[model samples]
Target: MKSLQDYTTVIRPDNNGIFAAYIPLLSGCHAWGQTPDEARAELIYVFEMIQEEYKEEGRSLPEDVELVIANAS
Candidate 1:
């Protein structure tokens, strides 16, 4: 079973200087804020909403999504 924490989260500052956070595996699951923490907090709310919707529709999140860290040499 996969939980929300199991998904990979990508956060970066956009050209406008707003912080954006999202789970790439979940389509339409993204949020933006003035800071990284704010963006992530909003994203968590969005995730909960999406999760509820999935539950209502009898759908389960994909099992293959996982967090990965890579280093650039």
Candidate 2:
């Protein structure tokens, strides 16, 4: 019942001009695309795939954690 938006995704542009995305909550889950939107789409697919795997394995899905950023200086 968890939507893709429920999870936090970190998207960044790689040096190769490709966009990369990953969910910190889910280990070993990642995706890459030509653009940010594409990267996000791929990440959604990855999320769904991992969720299904967890369900099949009778494992509980990880809960989302709040992320906060602060300046060091």
Candidate 3:
């Protein structure tokens, strides 16, 4: 998979204690969670979805594809 670019993830709390996971790289694919853990979990799915989309679409995975860890706190 040739990565076109890398993306950043921003996680923030919501009104209901759920976090909004944002992929700075992608315009969409945000997920909500009742907790930071939940948000993180959702992010996994979001990330996977994007990869699958590319695979199913017969597209190559971006070179930037990597596990988001530095952004984690």
lDDT of 3 by residue, 1-73 (tens): 4221255567898887678987765645688898877887887787778777878999865443455567656
Reference-based lDDT, each prediction: 0.87, 0.89, 0.70
Over 1-73, each residue of candidate 2 has an lDDT whose tens digit, in order, gives 6777888889999999999999888897899999999999999898899989988998978789997869999
TM-score of each: 0.82, 0.86, 0.64
Least lDDT summed over 10 consecutive residues: which range in candidate 3?
1-10
- Runs in model 3 deviating more than 4 A are 1-6, 61-73
Q: Per TM-score, what order, best first?
A: 2, 1, 3
- TM match of model 1 to true structure: 0.82
State residue 33's C-alpha deviation in candidate 2, in Å: 0.3
Task: Candidate 2: list runs displaced more than 4 Å.
Answer: 70-73
Candidate 2 vs candidate 3: which has greater lDDT?
2
